[model samples]
Target chain A: MKKRCWRILAVVFWLLLWQTAAMAVNQRILLVSPLETLQALFSLLQTAAFYQSVAGSLLRILAGFFAGLVLGVGLAALAKIYMPLREMLFPVMSAVKATPVASFVILALIWIPSKNLSIFMAFLMVLPLIYSNFLEGLNRADAQLLEMAKVFRMSAFNRIRGIYWPAAFPYLLTAMRLSLGMCWKAGIAAEVIAQPKNSIGSALHRAKVFFSTPELFAWTLAIILLSVTLEKCMLHLVNRLGRGLENAR
Target chain B: MRVERLCKAFEGKPVLTDCSFSFPTGETTAVLGPSGRGKTTLVKLMLGLLRPDAGTIDPEGAKTFAAVFQEDRLMEHLSARKNLRLAVSTPDQQISEALTALGLPARDETPVSQYSGGMRRRVAIARAVLADADVLILDEPFKGLDPAAREVAANFILSHCPRAVRILVTHDGAEKSLMQVKNVLDLGMAKEA
Candidate 1:
């Protein structure tokens, strides 16, 4: 409780500082007060446009996140089962890791429509993290437990559920915690470049063009709020799933 | 199971060389050895977890196996009963009963991560004893137990272990009688006074 109070106080302190600096500047185009930002946010929430933009962006980002998760886990499994496939993927994996997100966004824009760019970018950001960590976690399987499982003549499915899941779950959780935030950031960035009609990124672009600093702050706040909320939900699910599986075994 | 001319070495050091033994049905065979005498290597070879440098282990029509490795290999994330329950075809009540017989918590709510060394060893014991298998291999299964507790564990093994051949790797001479072992293979004969 004390920690939560401290966090709230810290947020209030920063907002006060921002408000003071905005008043000092006295230029609406240059700065926006916290009060003005909040007012802008409230007014934006009253519009159908706000909900349409939020829903569209939320759907696009979530689609990308889920797609990345499935492909990441599936590819990790395939790579583990087939070493030749892993070898084939090495160069591409390295390229994805080394290349900047902006480069991929721009490059992808040429190959696919702007509406599809967020999916590609989010998948790009998440794939290597899940792939490498999962492989590492799989490698870290407890030898003693594995030997015990073998002696018991456990079937392959049981072996995975009982032995491997406990070993590999932390990696999965880590990948998710990292990638969910990444997918949103990359997804929004993709939208800014692509200018999809009903998107937070397109709204942000318009706010920039109009010099509506308060509107820009409101949208930025919305992005942060959504990111944190999604993170909490995802991590809660990960922890519960991990404990449930461990207890089930 | 028949182990013939079984040889294994790590790097260049010879652990076991040309060791031959046939485990008989309806009996317990104790392989008595001190540390560094290839006892564990032998157990691993028998369990087919490691490839022997040379030789063979013929199952002799025995289809299934259960074992307690030197390390208490219970899943640390699971409760003691859950670990035992995962390994066998027995009902959950029977699993708890087996744990109870060995003086372990029947419905332990705590994960095995919090278990004492002796408690973990006992859980491993319960898992092996409760498994429905043709053969049992126990490597230093009584390592952390006191003499009194050792007798409880030994008795449980005798009563519950299948009549088919069971192999026990231990250093305790008293265990030979305590477990009512029918045959003893002293791997440390080279060092035994």
Candidate 2:
């Protein structure tokens, strides 16, 4: 309870400082107070178009995240089983990790429709991170346990559930936590560039063009809230899955 | 099972050189040695977890092997019952019986990670015994157990694996008599080249 009080106090302090700064500037177009931002957000919440934008962005980004997750896990398994595949993937993964998100967005924009651009960007952002972390986790599995599995002649399915899953779970969770935030940020950036008709990014773009500083701040706040909420939900789900795997007989 | 002229080395330092022994079926063969005597190397070779620099381990038609390794290699996140189920397709009744015989709580949901050292060791042993393999390898299987628990574990193993070619790897000479091991291969006396 003490910690909660301190946190609330700290947020209020920051908001007051921002309000004072906005008043000093005396220019609403350049800087909006926290109150104005919240008011703008409340107005956005009242609109059907705002809901559509939120839904559209959420669906595309989450779709990309799930797709990246599945592919990353599958590819990591394949790489673990086959050495040549790991060798083949190493350079490609390195390149993907090194490449700029904007370069990909610009290149992808030419090939795909604006509505699909964020999906591709989000997937691209998430894939390498999940792949590397999961592969590292698999590589870190206990050698002694693996030998025990071999001696027992455990089936592949049993080996994965009993041995591999436990080893890789923490790394996968870390990947998910990291990639969730990145995917959202990259997805929004792609949407901003691609100008998808009904997306939070396009809404943000519109707010900026019309000199609606409060609306811009409101949209930015919404993105942060959504990112944090989604990340927490995903991590909780992953932890539950880990528990299920552990309890599986 | 038979090992003929088995040799193994690590980093060019010889651990076992031209060692041979026959492990009789339906009986326990104890491999006795101090640390660094290649007792584990021999066990690994027989289980095909390691390659002998030179060797031919004849299983004598045995297809399946189970082991309680030096480390209790239980999936740490899983309960004792789940660990057993991973290797053995045996029913819950048999699993519970095995756990009970080994002095572990048969229906406990606690993961082996939270168990005491001796409890984890028993889980590893139970997993091996329940596997019902053609060859059962027990590598210091009772390391962490008290004398009474050790006796119970030994008896459980002996009774369950009656038909298996059992190989007991231990430096402790008392284990040979405890497990009723008739054939003894003392690697301490063998020359390491």
Off by over 4 Å in 1: A1-9, A247-249, B190-193
**lDDT digits (tens) for residues B1-193 of candidate 1:** 8998888989898888888888887788999877888899888888888999999999999888888888888778788877766677688889878989999878778988998888888888888888857888888889988999899998898888648578988877787788778887777773343
TM-score against truth, every candidate: 0.94, 0.97
DockQ (0 to 1) for model 2 = 0.85
Q: All models, DockQ values? A: 0.72, 0.85
Which one is best on lDDT? 2
What are the chain B TM-scores of all models? 0.93, 0.96
Q: Model 1, residue A113: what's the lDDT?
A: 93
What is the C-alpha lDDT profile of model 1 across A1-249, one tens digit per residue? 999999999999998899899999988888989889889999999999999998988888888888878887888878878999989988888888899888999899999999878877887888888787787777678888888888897777667767788888888889889988988999999999998889999999999999888899999999999899999998998799777766664
Model 2 collision count: 0
CAPRI tier for the interface of model 1: medium
Best by DockQ: 2
Cα lDDT of model 2 by residue, A1-249, tens digit: 999999999999998999999999989999988889899999999999999999999999999999999999999999999999999999999999999998999899889998999999999988999999999999988898888888888899899988898889899999999999999999999999888988999999999899889999999989999999999999999899888776665
Instruction: Write the residue-wise lDDT of candidate 2 on B20-118 in tens digits.
Output: 888898999999888988888898898898888997889899999999899998888788898888888899999999888888899998988999999
